[model samples]
Target: MARLESTLMAFRAKNGFDRGIAAPQIGVQNRFVAIHLVGKHASPQEDALPQAESELFQHELNHLVGILAVNLVSKDLLSADELLNRFPSHVI
Candidate 1:
């Protein structure tokens, strides 16, 4: 799509790197993403879709379940007691 390409170009110009971009919900009610891979990254064959799709699906599913990155902090970053005290268990 022209919009997607222009956006990516603008981002690359502002930043110093070009990366993959995903265009979601292109068609009516289509729950699919169109991915554009840039730079000298892994080839389509090398980059397995099954594993990537699984992880992506899991992340999206987490949003539906209300489990976010902030909740999954490293133990080193915050102790169990500190984490529990800082954020309610139910909120996470």
Candidate 2:
């Protein structure tokens, strides 16, 4: 968890995101974290729900990084865990 936090910090710095919340910190169970609001627009109030932010970040990142196929496939009756169980190889 410490290493994950450190890596997330490094990623934020490298991307110039400057946002405090990251995806892996929550329960997204993947390497991608989505950052919606950034820079001066972000605040403590906006960040009150870190888990939601992380989930949203992961959703957006999935879209950006070409996970649409998996997303689409998972949109059916499958729960998130079920989808993951069906395609564990795509997690990273």
Candidate 3:
């Protein structure tokens, strides 16, 4: 959770995204990753897990950065169409 959070935080500060992902809600097969997306307007609900404060922040952050990166690339700012086209599959 801590590692994932760190990755999220780095991603957040860059993209300004606001989305939240509910792990239990989606049945990810493992508790390793719970939340999926937390957008800029959404609130961190009380139902959230008891993650380390820093870890939670980081995880959300990662999602934010991811959204921004995808948007930028899709906009032609980056040149990796072939790879992006097969996203959530072709590997990052």
Candidate 4:
């Protein structure tokens, strides 16, 4: 995992964006992924748990097929707020 961390650090240094990088981007087929949430606003664990696991897996699967999150969101299909509201939530 050292190599993954190092690569994430290097990308952060060069791109100035703090986000996670999937293993497929680096040609690793070990089915491992890393997320770097440093210095970001994180959602509450309880609230995020319902959808986080499925979302994370779907996200990685999308990457494997060259699809991105942005591609799934379009004003024609659904607004951002509408999409956010579709996820199951514990708190009203």
The prediction achieving the highest TM-score against the true structure is 4
Clashes of each: 0, 1, 19, 0
Cα lDDT tens digits for candidate 3, 1-92: 55545554656678875334423323333344434443443457655544454455555455444433344344444447756775647565
Q: Report the C-alpha displacement of residue 63, candidate 4, in angstroms.
A: 2.8
List candidate 4 stretches off by more than 4 Å: 39-61, 64-67, 74-92
Best by lDDT: 4
Question: Can you give the lDDT of residue 56 in candidate 2?
Answer: 60
Better of 3 and 4 by lDDT: 4
Candidate 4 lDDT by residue in tens digits, 1-92: 67777888899999987456677778886666666643444576644433555476568667767778889886666566766777547325
Candidate 1: Cα lDDT at 92: 56
- Candidates ranked by TM-score: 4, 1, 2, 3
Q: What Cα-based lDDT does every candidate model obtain? A: 0.54, 0.57, 0.47, 0.68
Q: What's each prediction's TM-score?
A: 0.33, 0.28, 0.26, 0.51
Instruction: Kindly indicate the candidate among 1 and 4 with the higher lDDT.
Output: 4
